[model samples]
Target: MPYIPTRYFCLIAALVTLAIAVSARFATNDYFFFAGYVVLQYVVMATAWNILGGYTGYVNFGTAGFFAIGAYSAVVMHKLFEPPLVVSIAVGGVMSGLVGLGMGYLTLRLRGVFFAIATLALAIVLQTLITNWDFVGGSRGVYIIRPANGPFGHPYIQYLFLTMLVLSTIAVCIARAIEHSKLGYGLATIRDDELAAEAAGVPTLKLKLIATVLSGALMGMAGAPLPYYVTYLDPSSGFNLAFAVNSIAMPLIGGTSSWLGPVIGALLLATIQQIATVTISSALNLLIVGVIMVGFVVAAPNGIVGLFERGVRARRRPAKKEAA
Candidate 1:
């Protein structure tokens, strides 16, 4: 298609966010806001994961580790001295980004399955640490009290939904900006072949580190609101395998090649999961996600975006032949 300016994209995102906020005001049931919040959270997580896993060609299985860092960071803040939610969110992002940088420095040298294994190990290590830390409630978990009154007198859940909506927009816009930037090109080279990229003087390691930091920060920000949303957080919930699974699955299902893919994938999958949770049993949510992901892996390895791109190219081939 055509190259659209980032400013124009931001404007569109703002308008869409406004529309969602307005719609929430009219909704009678609070469940819509609750469910919407979760969907938007996945949108942020999936987009974040795509920065490294999709764009940089490094699959990170430690999504839950970074996510829990964000959540527990908030917990610590609340217990000591409750700061504004924004502050906790910012701190969470920074902590996760730092960890990402360290992880990249240590393991980016290892490619393929080895790197993936390292990240999964990182998650296992974090979970073990959190499980034993008594101050954060150890294995028992902790409870958080949501502020009784939210901004503008709206329900706290609505506020969270709006926060997540804005965050998802920011994440998408940032991803799109990177996709069109020099850094993105450098990262793409690394994705294609790190050795070749290094030989080509592409600064492969630096680019990969940047991708990891940005990806981790976004994931942490996505998790920062979890404490408030759930009102209770334990190692089990914070380190849930679902976060890692969904983060990888959504981008793959939507099409990882472009910034829009994860958003599309997250919206479709998360919404479906939400409906299934309500209609069927919540226990079946992961099963449903697994089944859908398997189908996509079998039939559309490149994802929905790839399928559409393929069709476009196919049509263009016939047109060029006719012209000749």
Candidate 2:
């Protein structure tokens, strides 16, 4: 037999562990399954936000706005056309992508704090519109009738978790591609110095819009199953500030420069929150997030990934000295 590399062995071990973890949820009850689903959903959302906010250096405070739009799109499709779950999710992505494209065109003109403020305002405006619209339940909220016996049964939690798992995987792949491609280079240039990027013939505007649309579309997809997951959707819940904060915080704390950063951050923070929600108070979970965010910002602005990289370099230094 051929020699198996350590990397492949590790990969197989990781996948086996994940499979066991997912399977364990089904062996338990619905609550644990749903809790796992929520964490996976946040992972998807955080990864989506990282595309624009982390890679492109654009802090979009309106992620919840896109998320809500996607949820409502799913709801509207379910009501009007009664499409299957797959079609509804596709519609959600399309609607959110179009909105994001328009927003990118409108606000890509602004830079830095100005762009952030614009996106934040966009979220508020969308929430206000949803509040007044009445057709899709308005601000009063929309209740979705849970579908009976999905592929996995009332293990709908498992189904949603699988969906989120796929979405997060896709997000990571997309982010990695962007980080390696010409687009990633252009984005890095734009991040480091926009004027320099433009002088080098990079189409900053186009790249920025592409990042925003891709990011928004992924976020929208993440939110598509949310209505069914929670079985309720309201302006307050759909467009909550927690979405914006979590999306931004995960990437920033984990290391925005790399694709793994947001995923790492999401896993760490979400696990902490879940554990805290059980052992401590839910309010304390948010407090913990806040404290972690502040600590990261002040002490390790480059994030955990950056720290890890520095450590790796430091360790390599001693080896080099020994060799010398």
Best by TM-score: 1
Please give, for residues 1-324, the per-residue lDDT of candidate 1 as tens digits: 987888898898889888888878899998999999999999999999999999999999999999999999988888989888888889999999999999999999999999999999999999999999998889999999999757768888888888888999899999999998899899889889888988989988888999999999999898888999999999999999999999999999999998989999999999999999999878887898899889999999999999899999999999999999
**Estimated TM-score per prediction?**
0.98, 0.92
Worst 10 residues of 1 by lDDT: 148-157
Cα lDDT listed for each candidate: 0.92, 0.84
lDDT of 2: 0.84
Who wins the lDDT comparison? 1
How many pairs in model 1 have backbone atoms within 3 A of each other, for residues 3 or more apart or on separate chains, i.e. clashes? 0
